[model samples]
Target: MAQKNYSGVNISVDEEGYMTDSSQWTKEIAKEMAKEEGLNLTEEHIKLLEFIREKVLSGSALTIRAIGKSGFTDIKGFYQLFPGAPLKKATKYAGVSKPSTCV
Candidate 1:
């Protein structure tokens, strides 16, 4: 694990930069992470991130197909939102672990 500063808070993260403690997450931290990824998060993005966090916290498997069925956005839209690696990026920004489905 490593410590990263975001929104002036030092957060614990894995070697891959995924947050190690979801309770330490904040919207400001998410925005900072998104900005680092060249994204300017909008309300839709926040909503989708929230959905991802909720599902992960509930011990549900995260997958592109499940996200598509989430009504938050379809698979194509998810790809559009996170671009190159949707599930990886989304879970990272959502302050959750990388989904087992991601490379």
Candidate 2:
């Protein structure tokens, strides 16, 4: 695990930089993480992150297809939002564990 300071709060993250404790997450932290990932969090991004966090905390498996069906955006739009590895990046910004579906 490693410590990353975001908005003056120290967060514990894994080697891959996924937050170790979701309870430590905040919108400010999410924005900082998004910025580090080269993304600027828009209202849409925050909504998606909130959805992702809620799903994971509720013990639902998160998938690209699930996100596509989420009504926030389609799969292509999801890709466009996070780019590269959408699920991975989204989970990170959501301050949750990396979904098992990823890699």
Best by TM-score: 2
Q: lDDT tens string, model 1, 1-103?
A: 7899999999999999999999998889999999997998898999999999999999988889999999989999999988999999989999999998544
lDDT of each: 0.92, 0.94
* Span of 10 residues, lowest total lDDT, candidate 1: 94-103
User: Per-residue lDDT tens digits of candidate 2, residues 1-103?
Assistant: 7999999999999999999999999999999998987789999999999999999999999999999999999999999999999999999999999999644
Name model 2 segments beyond 4 Å from true.
none
lDDT value for candidate 2?
A: 0.94
TM-score of each: 0.94, 0.95
For every candidate in turn, the CA RMSD to the true structure comes to 1.6, 1.4
Q: Score candidate 1 by lDDT.
A: 0.92
